[model samples]
Target: MRFEIMNAGKIQLCASLCMWLGIVTWTGNMKLHIWSVFVQQSYEGDVVFSVLNEQVNVSKGLRDGKTFSIRSPVTRKNAIEHRVFWSAWLDSLSTRVFGVEHERAWRKQVRDARVVVLEAGCGRPTNRLATFSDGTRACVRYGIDADQVLGETLSYYLAELLGISNLPPLALSKLNLSSEQWASVRGHIEALEWSPNAIVSLTEFIPNVTGVFIPLHLRKQQGGLQLSPETVSNMTVTYLVELMQWSDLIIFDYLTANFDRIVSHIFSLQWDARVMERTTNNLLKTINGHLLFIDNEAGIVHGYRVLDLWERYHRLLLGSSCIFRRSTVRRISEMKRSGDSAKLLCELYRAREPLARELGSLSQEHALTLQNRIDVVYKHIQQCTDIM
Candidate 1:
């Protein structure tokens, strides 16, 4: 299976190159020197095209009065920057949806509101759909083990720190029979045998969200999603927006080492070769096309503990992505430069979660591991830039 996947990736890479060459030829500005270099590189087993190669073709296209379908030159750097600019412009023209302030308000509401009812069937059997006194709903996750709750809470905050807003606002709650918040659901909690003082996480429930499948380009038998000039030029606006979010998702999962979403499917490929064709687990898309990253119980704590078995798959997924959000990259760069990523994360988790002490903080070892992963990601970004 591994060999087959590798072979498929190579074939897809070659096909992408062929498609790019066709585009260049069609534009009627194909240069002899560029063709010669491409041939030489192909002979040397260096199939990845450099950003400069793309720039030359785009410049030639413009000089020859050839117009591109997309607004920007679809080179790696330019395409990514243009998409980022578009996203920012769209935000400026309208009230920012799911912006920082909106998330902050949602968090406050979920944290302070009283839980008026708890019923089964949010996503998992163990989780409950909670109705608050204010008529808002949240998905209450009752962790069979404490680590699940911890992972969910910490991962949400980590995403927040990285400026990734795809994750819904999350808050921690303690089960207390005497508290008014649990008064209506006290018997329900007892029926489930939840501990009185246990801490669980409540994520703001998103309505009318549809399941999201892994993008076709990222599937097992294709060359992973590449921001090559031809590829981006052919993409629709909706595709560009989703791809932008996906780039952030890859970075987030990599940093958290979350294996439940993409990695698990990759692992399953060994047994079920068609697994990647299915909708990804714990991922959903809103009616308006915003992705909601849910069910992060496998992030941080459990993910780190089992890293030895899954790190290779995690690295594979991370390596397959190149384009990224500028704001996310900036935050990562700042964290990498300051060398205080661990401290900053710890402070955020401790300050925001009142039950943090009771639930326990991330261990020094895990904190160090988190810092190391951040450093690795920063270096990966540098490597991507170097290729550009």
Candidate 2:
């Protein structure tokens, strides 16, 4: 599996090159503020939004921001754990795939998921949750987390919204099930004091969310040996070799959980695979069969968000972690000899002239960051190129 996945080659900062060539542009400075009514009254929260350019106070709980209503998604009091989790997942893939380019695209993917949706690894519905109108086709929100505590909160939240007490009853009719599958499902139903068939049937979940916020954190923890970062002084290579195997199962679960609806109307699912490093960047499924893979790690790293990584780096990296050495150059080079993706990534990284000219003309902070990025990525490209 690692060999097949590696065949796709290590994608380089070519996302940088692509950006320079007008395919995508890197963004380091972008305002992200949608202060919600819920965030205002919290004990630990402060409310501030630009009402006029005067930046007035908003204490009355104005609901003019982006939300379905004052009461749609489940509300949780303490929500930072999940927010950090989602950001971590995004950080890992963002730097590697679309380095220096996916700043906006990543959020856009989740925001634009207008059809079938799944918020995998949803700790709490804290950041940028989706919204749909009444006529919207089964815009069912499915959030799955491995943590029972989190799941308990999420299930309760959903039940309150759906007007029931226990686990969500299937909101559709005609569940698709083979004999064995049905028997297994029946057993689960009987054991739990819950009935997924009451409001809707199992069949209606088709084209629906299998597990909306399915948490792959469990898989990551179980697969710890494979995803561990091996360090040698400064060079850190997160050995994400074994995670490819679970990609299909993850998608299958997503599909099964949402199998309640067939999605006649346009249903968009923001498949946020924050965990499972290797597979998170993989193009697992597509909207109506259109393959979509969003790699925005580069943007995160260059944006100075690595402060988060740097803080927790010791926890994730082995002590043997050494400063990235010249020897590490061969690691990338060996790939370029046989891997197309590596070559593409390297070329993108090396396209300094176009990048500096295109992106250099932006704000001072952005220009400085892009220049710093080009220098680092180029060093890697140059070190590896001579090896092959």
Candidate 3:
């Protein structure tokens, strides 16, 4: 028995040493290959060397049983090449999935048209299903507080700026009973006890939207959403379209720190282990296979305020996938480089909304936080690109 124990100990030590040597050899070869590619392709050597250093550290960590901070679905040698193709495919997609011109017209209509009716049937009691004089319908969110309205409105613009057309077109309105837009709904507004001059937001009411389920790949216990040529080739066109939108969804949520959707499900995993099987909150799918991100009232303002408690879950969701849309990454990179994300967002909001002064804007502190979050997301994407 003593001899057997000694032999087992020796075997374990030898196995560990072999693993370490294998990792070192692999790292050295990967560095050399990357360096050669940089030289041959005329790519910046400094960036290539930095990425190589990171890869070496990651290899060392793996050998020591340490997990990577950002996880990738593709772990094969051709992952970087696969990622390039995937990003190009995403970038090649039309940015007008929701019809940018139509959305602009819809916003104008929603903002200018008269509100003919207000009913209590648009998901929540505070949100009214409204009819405009032009016979168009909208969901009017009479935010419980100013922050909620600000969050929803600004989040929409942020998505727009990022070239993500998932959120419906939004316009701001005030609860003035004397205004031509709200005069017809005065009785209903008064009955609801809404204060005069309270700012609210109106979103285009999408018909025939169904709840979206978390994809099996994202719900897996091990890792989330692998991106590779082999994996993508097996996917049906519809699945691919939805996954493409989902990639944007993840990035948007991470930047906004919006925990009311996937992050909430992750948080629920502590108690309801099967929570991921359910439909995602605030996510809806059109019959044509486009995803609509709804109820963004929790995104920027409230989401940032509660970041202290929810940031880990936010990071967990953000770090799950290595793939992202190319256009989205470009926008993020630009914002990070310019350091004007918050300023740009605010300017867009104020310019578009006529009652911007009444509604107010993001505080200086929150604006700074928003910029910082953008920087963090940019860095994470850079790290992901390097690893891939």
Candidate 4:
């Protein structure tokens, strides 16, 4: 099965490249380079296209005036753990194909399990929790169309590739619910009856987690903690809020080209519901303070789709926001100095073959565009030396 999948993907990639080349010829300004890398005049100078043999080096220098203020929370222990997690994730991708095998086994195990809808999920998709025949429950995110399912599934693999541990294991599953069950929640779904059997994406459900939040000004007025504009600028306060997770998340968002994460949307908190209810502003203090990032389906489409140039880097990396932590900046800076930054990133992306093959609509061109964004991140990291 894997061999057939691999072969079919190669064929599709060849066909897509042929069509792309034809389009490029008609356009007369795009150049298809070696190593599946290409450039078009429309790209401006934002992306540098090169073959695999090409070496990219950005000089390290402190940019003027934007000094990072806070102490980094990415201690030696934390960095080691992150490194270990990344290594395990890469190995899983290369050998086990992580979610693929897990999903296969899980589906077979849950085949006889009863399914039930829990509630409407947070995003565009009508997501709900359903119980399996074995009395186990999983979060089911239905695809309005095949494309959305692909996006969600691909995002899960991409998150793993980036060493994001916040996400639970995900797999493709089919919901076997009665029509009446779906009808009860039909009003919440955009296309409840679009397809038969309702093909869905399943994620392992984590218990005891709640969305993080900032104290509302109104709440703060009633003796709640107030978050002044300068609060984020304060390094001590930022570090107290878990700077490592904050920085890692920002970098992850930049690489994935996801801009939906607003400052208002806080991180996920575990075991702190009581304290969270007390705080009206976006702040949380936990033992480890791990940030659980959900709804990653919004990424993997930055350069693939046509949008305004100004909207690029709509978040802090390219935007005017300076809310990122010093620890985050230091992590990237350390990588730049280590000289293994590009090599590590390239290895991490090497597992893209199986993932892209599964996502039928995601072409090699789109994959290359994602790499272009990663290249941009490499350049962006060079500016991080000035961070603190």
lDDT tens digits, residues 137-237, model 3? 99999878889999998899999889898888888987878989999989889999888989899998989889999988788766576566667544443
Q: How well does each candidate superpose onto the true structure, as a TM-score?
A: 0.76, 0.21, 0.77, 0.48
* Model number with the top TM-score: 3
lDDT of 4 by residue, 1-388 (tens): 0111123234533332333223211222222222323321122323222222212221111111111222322222212222212212112211111245564576455444445445554445466766554567777766555566665666555555555555556655443344543444444344455455555666665555555553332123132222232332333323433433444555666655554453222222234434435432322222223345665555555423532431343333332222333434445445555544434443433343233333354556556655665555556544432331
Q: lDDT (0-100) at residue 146 of candidate 1?
A: 95
lDDT of 1 at 276: 86
Model 3 accuracy (lDDT, Cα): 0.72
* Clashes within 3 Å, all models in order: 0, 57, 0, 12
| Cα RMSD, model 2 | 26.3
Candidates sorted by TM-score, best first: 3, 1, 4, 2
Q: Model 2 — TM-score against the truth?
A: 0.21
For model 2 the local lDDT of residue 6 reads: 16
Candidate 4, which segments miss by more than 4 Å at Cα?
A: 1-119, 122-125, 175-191, 214-241, 263-288, 302-310, 313-361, 386-388
* Per-model lDDT: 0.72, 0.24, 0.72, 0.42
Per-residue lDDT value at 200 in model 3? 90
What tens digits encode model 2's per-residue C-alpha lDDT throughout 6-90?
A: 1121142223223322345444322222222221223443321111111122221111111111111111221111211111221
